[model samples]
Every structure is written in C-alpha cells, then in structure tokens.
Target: MKLRETLEAQEFEPYIHITRGPGDGGHWARQYAHRFDLVLISGGDGTICEVINGLSGTDKPIAIFPSGTENLFAREMGVLPDCDQLIQTLKWGRRVVMDMGQVNHRKFLLLSGVGFDAHVLLELNKFRTGNITHLTYFWPIWRTLWEYRFPPMTVEADGEIIVENARGLMFVSNISRYAVGLRICEQARYDDGLLDICFYHCTHQFRLVKHAWNTVMRTHCRDSMVTYRQAKKIRVTSTEPIPFETDGDPVGNLPAEFSVIPQAVRVILPP
Candidate 1:
C-alpha cells in the first residue's frame, strides 16, 4: 500500500517533503515542525541525521522509515524496512527518548568518528556523485588507508584527559555498532545520558588491521592499546588539521567539543 493510504488508514494526514539538496531536510523540518505532531524520515542515515538536526530543541517524535540510505540509527533502534511494520509503528509504537550528541554546533543521533574513518568519509564525499552502496566504499577505504597519516590528538572527557595526543581513530558513539557491523563502541547506550568513546591506538597498517580484527571479534576492550570510556561531555583537540565525522557524513576538522543531550529525541520503536 502507498504511504498516504497507510497513513490515512491510521487517521494521520501525511505531508511529504522531498529534500531538494543537502541540508534542505533539516531546514524544512525545523521550519515546519511546529505544525506537525510527529515527523517521519523516509531516507537513509544522512537524511535521518539532517532531519534530526532540524528537529532539535523540540518535543516532536520522529520515526525512521528506511530508504536506500544506510540506516545505521534505524538498526540500533530496531526499525526495519517492512511497510506494515512502518505503518503500524506510525500509530501504536512505543515512544522512547534517546540521547543526541553534539559536536561543535552540529547534532548527531548515532555515531561520530575522529581521524581515520573521518578521513575515509572525506575521501568518499569528494567523489560521491549519487547514492552510494556498501560496495562504493571499497576505493575510498583503500585510498584513505594508504594516504591517511595517523594524526596525533588529545581527548578530554568531562574535563579529565583520557588519551593524551594519541595517534589512531577515535569513535564517540551513541550506538554500539558501526559500519560492517563492527561494535566499535560496544558500551554505547542511546538513552544512557552519556557518550561512549573508543580509541584504537593505531600507528601502522599492521596495527590498524589488528584493531579492526579485534573490533570485529568484540575483543578490543580487552586489548591494552584500546581505550574505552564514557562521559557526559568530551573535548577533542589537535594542533594539526585532524578531521572528524558525525553520523557517517564528514563534518569538519577538530578542535571540537562533544556533549550529550540526554532524553532529547523522542523516537517511535517496535513494541
């Protein structure tokens, strides 16, 4: 059945807004949120991130209807692509409040990456012309691995320094799992009022490979080189131009401060 038909069956008046370009989803969502009781995002992770940013500072409940984009947040929220499930969720789903992470001035609902993965996303965004599939990541990851030099950075969580001038990838995540199902921040909890930070102390290609293997095996927490912590606020800085990404999109270079907005976003989930 069509979305409009399904919504009408549930006594909802559907309002469809097709995003014209980047940031349009957030712009429109912010502009019109006062008029709607709930907002449904029918796109992938990027689109969902945009809409979530738009809906910040409001009590509006948002629902994720997975489209062609990688719905990593949806995965964490137990949202699926089934039409009947989506429609039923539109009406009778449980309302759960999830934490939102803010880095610099931008808000992210799922995960954020600093260093290596951000470098990979930066390269991917450079050549990204259209919708990308999982296969589209091959060239970017390979190119970034060879080209990216491990930039040194320091991390301060809740005003205490955890890793000082570390060289590797740092993940500040609201969700546990990452790309290819790697539980990069396995201790993350969306409603926990804190952000989980995981750092893989990688200095060479061999160590990077080893860290990846450990992350896949869910044994990185046991490795001494891997650092894991959770806090309400985090400050990451680098004198060098180190990049960072939030919710799979490359945002900007660090000297960024991250903080958690607990019980911020109200999302509908399968009951």
Candidate 2:
C-alpha cells in the first residue's frame, strides 16, 4: 500500500513535502515545521544533515525516511523507509534523544571525515546531478587516491597535541558505522556525550588500500598505525589546506573545530 494509505489506516495525519534541489531541506522544514508535531524527512544523510542544521534551534522531533543514495545515518540507526516499519515507529516507537556533532557551527548527526574521504566528496559533488549510486564513487575515489596531495595536519583532542605534522586521514564519528557498512570507529556512541576520533596514520596509496580492507573486516581499530580516542572537543589545523565533509556533504577547507551538542535532537526508533 502507499504511505498515505498506511498512515491513514494507522490514523495519522501525515504531511508530505518533496525537495527541489540541494539546500531545500532546511527551507521546507522551516516553512512548514510549525504546523506539525513531528517532522519526518525522506532523504539521504546529506539531505538529513541540511534539515538538522535548519532545525537546530527548534524543539520538534525529527524522523528519517531514508530516500537518498547513501543513507549512512539511516543504516546506522537501523531505519528503513518502509510503510510498515514507519507506521510502527510513528505509532509505537519511543523518542530517544541523540547527540549532534558541531564543526565550525554546522551540525552533523552521523560522522565527519578530513583528508581523503573529504577529497572524494569534494570531487563527487562536482558531478552530483541529484542522482548518485555506488558506481558514482569509483572514479572519484580512484582519482583522489592517486592524484590528491597528502597535507600535513595538527590535531588537538581535549587540549593535548595528539598529532603534529601528520599526513593521514581523520574520522570524527557520532555513529559507529560509516558508508558501505564500514565500521571505522566502533566505539562511537550517539548518547555518550563524546565524539569518537580515529586517525589512520598512513599516506601511501597501497597502505590506504590495506587500511580499507582492514576497515571492511572491522579490524582497523586495532591496527598499529591507527589511533582512536574519545573527546568532547577537537581542534584540527593544517600546514596547507585540508578538505572535510560532514555526513557526505563537502563543507569546506579546514582549520576546523569539532564538538558535540549533547542530547540535542530527539529521534524516533523502532521498539
């Protein structure tokens, strides 16, 4: 059955809004947010991130319908945009408060990456024409890994210098799992009031390929070249310039600060 039929059968007054382009997530939510008790967004992580940023100062709870290319956040939350499951969540699910990460004033609910992954996102955004799939990443990743220069960066976690002049990849995670089912930061907790930071201290292409395989196997956290920590605040700077991405949307070049807004957004989950 259709979503409207399902919701109507469940006795709910559901509101539907479709986005026209990038950056419309916030607009749609802001324009119609006051008319509803709960806002259910149907998009991938990037679209959800835009909505989160728009809903930063509001009190209404948000739910996801998972309708984009890489639904990383939905995958992490075990949410699928099926009528049965959505109805179940809307009718019987509990509302749990989840933490959102802030980097230079922007909010992200999933994870953020600096260096290689960010470069891939930067390249991917150039060709994103509202349709993206797994195959769309192949060429971008290949080109970035081979041609992108590794910039040295300095990282401070909780006021201590953990990395200085290092050429590696950094992942600040609010969720344990990443894109394509990779658990890069297994220690991440959405309610723990901290961000999980993982550093892959390898710049060579072959080593990164090995690291990718290890991440797929969920063993990257234990590798000797990897450093993992939990912190409420982190500051990152680079000698040149470092690209960064939050929830798969390329944000900007870094000299960035990352911190968590503890228990800010309430999310409805399957009971």
Cα distance off (Å), candidate 1, residue 153:
1.3
Please write out the lDDT profile of model 1 over residues 1-271, one tens digit for every residue: 4777877887778888889988899999889977988898888888888888888888999988888556778888889888799877876899999999999978898989999988898888888988899988999999988888888899999999999998888999999979888889998999999999998888888889899888888999999999899999999999899989998888899898999999988999877
Candidate 2 lDDT over residue span 1-271, tens digit each: 3766778887888777777887888887777787899988887787888887777778888878898877878887889878788988887887889899999988898889999999998888788775888999998999998987678888899998888888889999999988877889899989999999999888789889899999998898889888899999999999787999988878899899999999988889876
Model 2, runs deviating above 4 Å: none
Show how many residue pairs clash in every candidate, following the order shown: 0, 0
Cand. 1 TM to true fold: 0.96
Best-performing candidate as measured by lDDT: 1
Each prediction's TM-score against the native?
0.96, 0.96
